[model samples]
Target: MIPGQGGIVTRFAPSPTGRLHLGHAASAIRAHDFAVTRGGRFLLRIEDIDGTRSRPEHVAAILADLAWLGLRWEGPVFQSQRLDLYAEALAKLDAMGLVYRCYCTRAAIAASLSAPHGPEAVYPGICRNRPRHEDTDAPHCWRLDVAKALARTGPLNWWDETAGTIACEAAAQGDVVLARKDAPSSYHLAVTVDDAAQGVTDVVRGIDLFAATHIHRLLQALLAVPTPRYRHHPLLTGPNGERLAKRHGAPTLAALREAGEDGRALADLLRAGRLPTGFSARNA
Candidate 1:
């Protein structure tokens, strides 16, 4: 689906691994506003792909938090319930010779690297040519052969609200894992598939995920999914200029509400680009 073709459709997909923080609030409010302002549909998707870390309490808290902020969504889809859809997408990629089994563990990959690299380091393609086991029970994750996939799709680009038309550089991310050994799908595969299935015309998310859009674009081409317009807004940061995160001790929305903060008021402030004391929006 394309934006402006059949109205705009956006979503706020959050993982249920932790409580919703201010950063998440900023993102949700932006997405909600973008859809509501355009008479479009807003969706809430529970990214509970990591079954081990996802909690039912967190999911409930997310719903309660969004509602408290005066944001209403059409349907709260759960990634856990859409395993079959992800499997079918992966099968299509596998049939195209773009999917391969990767048996490298985190430790193994780290040890194999000659030097330290950025957090989003390119996967060294250690298992790209490994012999595929006929046994389905083998403990291995599926990774996309980025080089081969790019060869099929050739040069590509996507439209972004802020960046205009941007060239895709999927190869920079290397071969991304599509499905984990213990999970049905990875974030790249699941989000790409879900967006198309949900008919999302516009993808509103944080600027931190800007790089991942390259891989998503490539996946869309490989899976033949419709690409949506991207709007990656700025992220909320603390007094130290660091991004708000659970690990950084950012207060959760539940805690803010418990402290007598007005949810609607907070939402309004965020929508107006007026953040609370010691909080700022990081566009870069």
Candidate 2:
């Protein structure tokens, strides 16, 4: 059985890709406050499943940044160290025949006739029906057969603080990858497993991930794990009304620290639901 934490438990899981920016600060503040205010545990998790791009310096920077923002937690969980756990989860799904080998490459999926439209182009299911013998020497990843998975789990839904009870739209995501050729686990798989393993009771994150919770909810049901309550807070955008991103020159917390900015004061502003100067919050 997954060890239970009686009270609420929240985590601030950030990928070790870049320095923490104002957007990160806002999210961290939300989670940190949510847990502390209710006498719950605030945990930190480093989502470094992508070993190729995850850097040690970035991990260190994120830790330093969170501390600088006055956020404290019990322990920092690293996804890299939990490969065996993810492997077990994948093995369970495989035994259930809910996941299959997918050999399609990025270019191939992009050019497929069934390719999805718009900004979010989901998998076109090229390898979903391909026979085992037809599989080539191409590197393969494991994909969740959403149709089959839904058949087993039937209808599913989860609770969200702002949006209320939302139905799981797992089909809209198509056959999502459970294990990548590079990483042992995909975001959807690892997150679903980790949240339950960590006993996370309340997931506080940016609304940009609101849609992803659909897939996550399905995984929770399929895996028979507890579904945590969710709160997808508004995203912080810059003066141009664009969401804050490193490529968009979003100011980093490190830069602010170097400028002698008060981390605690900044966090206080975030707690009060206020954005500094040019930043604003909006649903994504």
- Among the numbered candidates, top lDDT falls to 1
List TM-score per model, in order: 0.95, 0.95
The digit string of per-residue lDDT tens for model 2 on 163-216 reads: 899989989989988999988999999999999999999999999899899999
Per-candidate clashes come to 0, 0
Task: Evaluate model 1: give its TM-score.
Answer: 0.95
Model 1 per-residue lDDT at 255: 94
Candidate 2: where are CA atoms >4 Å away? 1-6, 114-119, 133-137
Q: Write the per-residue lDDT of candidate 1 for residues 146-178, one digit (tens) a residue.
A: 999999999999999999999999998899999
Native-vs-model 1 lDDT? 0.91
lDDT of 2: 0.88
Name the 10 consecutive residues with the lowest summed lDDT in model 2.
1-10
